[model samples]
Target: MSFDDDPGRGGGDPADDRFSTLGGTRQTRTRLPESTGDPYGSTRRPQRGSRSLVMVVGVVVLLVAAIAFANRGSDSGSSPDGQSPKKPDAQSTAASGTKPVGGKQGGIASGYAHDEQGAQSAASNYAVVLGSEGMFKSSTRADIVRATHDPAVVDGLLSRLDQAYTPSFFKNVGLNDDGSTPSGLTFVSRTVPVGTKVAQQDGASATVEAWCTGLVGLAGPGSTKPVTQTWFTITEKLKWVGGDWKITSSSQTQGPTPVSGDDRASTADEIAKAVQGYGGFTYAR
Candidate 1:
């Protein structure tokens, strides 16, 4: 997950270092300790039993109704322009309220505005393209580099990437000398952004971190590098150029990963089929 090496081809640091610490979800149920006997059992004191019961029931009903009404109000709070209200997590982890740029360059999403939010959106989607299987191919790699990096740095970055994805490297990842998979195998390399955060912001410059989960390796019978998932985060330093956010420099590091799940791992054929059937998404914010 660094510029110097290619984890997409299984040639880099050990995955133990690339895992994130933020993907686990667990639920717990709690119950109050049960009482062995009623408080008034030994005292035998007369209580306002009927009246207290009625009062408690009425209070509980009022409380429940109040909570329901409050939640409804929270959910229905919309913009004056008839747009949906942004979620509470939007500012912290969810997609921004701003819409994604409605354009593409060399098949990669582009036209990000000159702002911190836009920079974050651009970095996220760009990360997706850069970490994909397309990077292994010469034509698509050139297009991705051109689309994501600033014009002045495009040539240099592309040259460095070209060396990184050498034929030997491709062979190590179960691809041929030209980065093509064998007839029966499917090469998979896809990066999925989980969240984005702006680390710094200025009028014309910004640094954003895109937390991502990726799938890499080959899938099929007798495949040496069976597809596996990894978690990592990419930081992109961007500048406002050509009326959009473009990468000046970028680096990736091990993740803020979570614990592995309990689901059974699918076979290679199952993985290949699933990958082919499911299309990827366009990330923003």
Candidate 2:
């Protein structure tokens, strides 16, 4: 079933009709008829008044244009020799200049640089771990929480999450009471960060937002809860602890979701195989 059709998984309408552009009304201009015979019955004197007005308007427009051009040139960072520097392409998906971290902790990327970019990377990776299928299982969920959260919050976060992913919750998503998938079915829960933004940062702390897309549910021929896609933004409050970024607190809101696409849904076998074949990335932006 489509995500929207599943009452258990609440989501907004896929039709993006919330916003619309208002049509502008056209303005009509009435032109005065030229005096064919000089209504005053005297010489028009070449309409010097109108001619002077036009000249004044033209000069004003030219002066404004010249000023604008001068300002633009100054702001464009042109060299002293009057040539502009080559700009990097806006559409380029180039790797960042920061070096990748060399280590992992508890199977998750760790040892991030202690900078804004590092905090962003940490937040994104944490989002992925928190949104994974492992979070549904008690044992792995404890490991994930301990690895991703600050030491002070790990116990409390683990306790809360354990309570949240209850037996009924597991069954609702086609998982067993122990969060295991039924035989012959594949349970899929994965989050891929599309981008990261540092909302706030200081010497020891940062607030980062990870815009993510995820797949969750069961993938199999007879599965009632087939894998469905979701979009969400995960905001993490991170602190530089133990020489690396760690989550102090985190929250998720539904989405800055895109409209649903027209692509046909893949079969359960194809989806299961693809998930098994393609590994997720270790985001570092």
- Please, what is the TM-score per model? 0.70, 0.70
Q: Tens digit of lDDT per residue, candidate 1, span 118-212?
A: 88889888998989888889978898888888899999888888889888999898899989888899999999998888899999899999999
Tens-place lDDT per residue, model 2, 1-285, is 443443322455322333311111112222345566877764423322334666899999999999999997768588668997788785324557676465898898999998887887788788888889888878788888888989999988777877888889998999999888899999999999988888899999999988999999898889999999999998899999999999999889999899998999999999999999999878887
Residue-pair clashes, model 1: 6
Ten consecutive residues with minimal summed lDDT in candidate 2? 20-29
Candidate 1 CA-lDDT value: 0.81
Q: What lDDT score is found at residue 28 in candidate 2?
A: 22
**Runs of candidate 2 exceeding 4 Å displacement:** 1-81, 85-94
